[model samples]
Structure formats: structure tokens, C-alpha cells
Target: DFPPLLISLGDLRRGFVFHEVKQVLITDEDIFKRYRERRQRWVGEEEKKIERWTELRGGDYVVHIDHGIGKFSGIKTLKLQGRKCDYFQVNYKGTDRLYIPLDQLDRLHKYMGDSDHPPPIYSLEGGQWRLTKRRVRKAARDLASSLLRLYSIRKVIPGYHFSLDTDWQLEFEASFPYQETPDQLRATHEVKQDMENPSPMDRLVCGDAGYGKTEVAMRAAFKVVMDNKQVAMLVPTTILAEQHHRTFRERIAAYPIRIEMLSRFQGLKEQKDIVTSLKNGGVDIVIGTHRLIQKDIEFKDLGLVIIDEEQRFGVIQKKKLRELRSSVDVLTLSATPIPRSLYMSLMGVRSMSMIVTPPKERLNVETQVAEYNEE
Candidate 1:
């Protein structure tokens, strides 16, 4: 191949090749200096990473394919060619030793396992198994892509149109059992702005459980429904959908909103009837577990989609949801971060509203820990 463009493409000099080219284009000296500074900072960060890897030792949780998650017992030193090399002694599976080299620390991660987490072990020398894993991962990615395409098509399709009015707002607010908290009010304002704005809304409402998140969602749903549009409430669990359906029915009972649920628990006849109603604008709001995403279900005027407990959704489900809500506005409510890595990657691109303050009535509980004998 020809010499790289960075080097001169001319005749050879006394000891080097030279070429006549454009002058240095460093017009902004400040920008050039900043670029260099950033590059140097990244280099320093990489050096720190390498230093950390080299000095890794005991008490650290190391993840190995065969050993899974285990605490480093200590290091074993071996003298080879007058130089000493260290190996990490990881304790796993009842005295199981995983001799990982200090150099390989880059492959490990700090294990932050929860109560339900199962210890992972090292699957060393399992090349065939890894290949199988790769194939499975690839298949899953392909399936997700297909589902996303379908969702995109659905989102682009225009659904129901809504009219702007404060009647539903007044009715819903009057029916609210408790006064709205400051966080709830802020979230409500954000959702309302998203719904009223001509541009499609894609907002995430993150907060702890029982923090009036559902109420905020209800307010948005009511607004959408009042606009002569349909709302889709997508939940990750059947139980949650049922709960939401009941809550929506109860909250909007004072209004003329017709909310329905479509889940596996319902018979085929019920699902069919609900789908028909959705297509004919008979149902004002439809709430269901991921079942709401099925191809058979059609929304007459799907204006807003509220995703509850979004962290419970898998990569495929979240992708599918995104596609379905591409054109329409989406409101995602979650306790923690979204489970899908894709959403995290696109966080800056998406709108997010966090309810950090707890409701007025909710109080923080203090806990006391003591020895059993002391009690």
C-alpha cells in the first residue's frame, strides 16, 4: 500500500522521504492546545488503569471464567529468569484456587453482587462454550433488530389526535386523594410540557417505589386521553399492569375514560374484543404487560405510551418499545436505571426527569443494629 498521508509522498531526502503539502491548519491555537491537553489526560487515565492492574492484590473481588466471583486470598510469587512474577490466589468453590496473573487484572471487574446474584465461576478453556455464547448473543441481537424495525414502523404511523383542554386536568386533580409533592409537581409539569409540545415527548421519570410515580403517569395519561387520543400503558409485569389498570379505572372513574387491560390472563375472546376496541377508538387507555406490544393489538389514536418499572424490561423489549414509540411520546417510569444498556448509551439523547424528593407523608426509617446477646 502507498505511504500514509500523514507522511510526505515525495522524493527521499538525506535520510527521510519528503513531500510538498498544505501548511499546518492550526488556526485556533487554544483549540489545538485543548485537544492536546485532552489527549494527554486520556493517556494519564490509561496509565492509571495499568498501574491499578499491576498492583491488584488480596481482598479484591476478581471475576474469572472458571472461578466466577471470588475474593483474592493473596499473591504467589514465582522466580523465573532472575525476575519475580505474581499470581493472584482467588478463593472460590470451597478452596478452589484461581491463579490469575497480575497482568490480567484488566479482564476482571469489581463484583457488586446483590442477594439474588449467583456466583459466577471461571469457564477456563471453554472455547466451544464461548463460541456457543457468541452465537446465542448474535441471534438475540438479530431478533432485537427485527423487533425494533417493527416498532419503528408502528411509531411512524399516525395514531389518534388529541385536543388541548384543561377540563380533564381539573377533573383529575380534583380526584387526586393526596396533595401533590414538590417532586411530583415538577414531574407533572415536565410531563405536561412534553404532552402539549408539538415535538414528540420521550421522557423518563425515575424515582423510588410508591413515590407517586404512578399518579404522575395517570395525570399524563388523562391529558392524552382527553385530547381525544388513546394511551398505551406498557408494564413489565402482569401484576403491575393489573394494578395500574385498577388504579387508572379508579382514578379516572369520575371522568368518562374507558381503560382496558390486555394480558395473558385474559381469554382469547377478551383480547380480541380489547384489540377491536383499541382499533375503533372505543378504549381510551390500554394497559398490559409487554402483551400490549403484540402485533394484533392496534391503537386507534395512540398518543402517549407510559412504560412502568422500565428497569425490568430486557434489551429486546426496551428496543421494541422504543420503535413503537418512535413517533409518539413515551414516558418511562423506573426505580433505578434502565436495564437496557442501549438506553444508558442514549441517555443524553433522551429526555429524563428524576423525582429525587420523597412524598410528604413518606418518612425515612432509622435502623438500629446490635449484638444478639445485647438485645
Candidate 2:
């Protein structure tokens, strides 16, 4: 017994059950120091900055600092003051054209406004656009300030720091049926990185249906289970809860992770047994409807909470969700995300990953434009 173990009570149904955690605690100074450092670490500011490499194409709409919204006409070479230079040709209302020098590219930005029913283009002489800009700037500033306060509070609170992925995790990933897209791989990497860190993660994954959002969640759940911490996936409908439960179990069938589901479909006895096991730290992951947020349910250790169809929840349910928000890792999945959700990420309250590119095997559609006819 040279290496002492930090043991706790195990299940009594099988007479004797000892669950060994992945990370071991050793008395050796070097070992203890290394584990201690991983236990309480922080992320740097450089990683928090969102990357901007937007590509603008012709026929795209744009906004100019001095001019109102307009459409891009592409680059045109011109000779000015006996010197040749490249210029971006911009088209505005009423045959008004503005040529901007390549050096002043900072004065133009992509327009993000309605196209089907766009707002009326204002005259350069009016202050209509200026007023709108002032209002938007004020709102963004208020959002940023509130988020800063939240970040300050989360920094001091410690969370369950999971160890890095093992060979088993690598094998599980390799066993995935379909090839992962680049964006999916990127999102998985970010989520895993967050789990390995000390601070709690608040991230959102947005994509259309069948874009592998569930796969990303599954990877994170598996990692947390390997660390001996429980995971909770909350859904708005009982159908979705049952669906996710089945999918999660099938994916981890090769492993020893104990998974359960909570919904009206389950009998009272079954529900009671699941809740008891969850509270006793016998269950690894629980997928359920909003009923999981009720008062009686308890978890010995909840490392991550995944919310699917988060937009469907009511205000009261949201309030209860807020109570569980503190010091706990949260992952939200949504397709056709709401403006409020995107705003939260823009304000730094949450990290967002968008998957827009479709899979390679998807068929390309052919469209031929023709004059409309009432046939």
C-alpha cells in the first residue's frame, strides 16, 4: 500500500463496489504540484478574442461611414494624379456612385440589414442613420458592461477540472460513423479544451438540423464521465428527451458509462430509482425534460448541463435554469438561433460556434432563374 487511495462509499447492491477516479492523488511533491496546477488554472485574453476574416463578394451590400447603405460593384483600376491605384466602386441610390481608394478600406463594412423588405435608404444629408447608430452603440455598451461583471464573478469560483482525453476517448472518436467536418472538429476541440480547464464553460453551438450538433454534445458528455462527474441534458419536449437518451446509450454501449432518462413516459418507480441513483453518484448522465429542474432532484456532482431547443423554454423555466447557471459548465444547441442568443455571445457572456458549411456528400442543387409567370 505504498500509494494511498482517496476512497468513498460505493454501491451496496453488488456487495462491494469501488469506483476509481481517473485522476489519482499522490504524495510525491512533483506529482501533487502538477495536479494542483491543473486544478486551478485560467484562460488568457488572447484566446477570448473572436477571429474576423470575413470575405466580401460582388453584388453584396455594404455600409460606408459617410454614405448610407449601398451595394458593392467590385474593384476598378483608376489613374489619379498621374498614379495608378485600385478603387472599390460603390453604387448608391439615384445613380450616385462613390469610389473609395484601397488604402481607405476601413471606412466600409458589410451591411447586415433586411433585403426582401429593406429599410428606406436615407439621404447623406439626413441624420436618420446616425440616430440609429447612436442607439445601437449605447445598447452594445450596456451589454458589454453586464457581461464584464459576470466574468469577474465566475473567475474566483472553482469548477470540476477534468483531466485531458485518454486513448479510450481517441478510440471512441475514431469509431464515429461519418467523417467530421472541419467546423465540427473545431467545435469539439474547443469544448474539450474548456472541459480540461479549471473555470466553468459557457458555450453555444448553432447550426441547422442534422449538422452533428448532437455529436459535439456526446463527446463532451463522454469526457466528463471519464472524469467521474455526472452530465445533465435538458430538453423542452419529452419526445426529444427520449430520443437523446436512446442516442447517448447507443454511442457509449462499448463503455461502462451508466446512462438514464427522466420523462413522463417512465413510471413513477423508474423515475424514483433514477433520481436516487443520480443523487448517490451512481449515474453518469441523465437526459430529461424540464422536470429535471424541480426541487427534489439532486446530483452528487454535475459537471456539465446541455440544453437542446433552448428557445422553447418559458420565462419561469428560464428563471430556474438561471439558478443552476452559477459555477456550472453549460452547453446550448440551437438551429435558427434567436437574436437574443447571438447577442449574448457578441457581448462576451457566452462563446459561440457556427456550422454553416454542409457535408461534402450533400447534393448540389441547380437553379435556373426565369421571369415569373402565373401558370
How many Å off is the CA of 372 in candidate 2? 36
Estimate, for each residue in 1-375, the C-alpha lDDT of model 2 and write its tens digit.
Answer: 433655443211122233564454334433345434422332231222212213557777777765757777888888766777778888777677788876666557776666797645545555666787678779778756655666666777876788989888889999998889998999899888887788888888998877789999999999888888999999999989989999999999999999999987789999999999999999999999988998889999998999898889986776576556667898889986557678878776678988776666866556799999999
Task: Estimate, for each residue in 1-375, the C-alpha lDDT of model 1 and write its tens digit.
Answer: 443334332212123223455233222333344344423433322222323654556666665442346676777886666777787677765545667677666445565556475555544444543565568669878866865665556446653344554865877687787878899989888888767766677678888887889999988888887678888998888888888889889888877779899898899999999999999999999999888887788777788888887778876787678676668888888887654423642555456777788777887666799778954
- lDDT of each prediction vs. the true structure? 0.71, 0.78
- TM-score of model 1 relative to the true fold? 0.67
Give one clash count per candidate, in the order shown.
Answer: 16, 0
Compute the lDDT for candidate 2.
0.78
With candidate 2 superimposed using the best TM-score fit, by how many Å does residue 55's alpha carbon deviate from the native? 32
TM per candidate:
0.67, 0.58
Task: Identify the runs in model 1 with alpha carbons over 4 angstroms from their true place.
Answer: 1-61, 64-73, 83-85, 90-107, 111-163, 339-347, 363-375
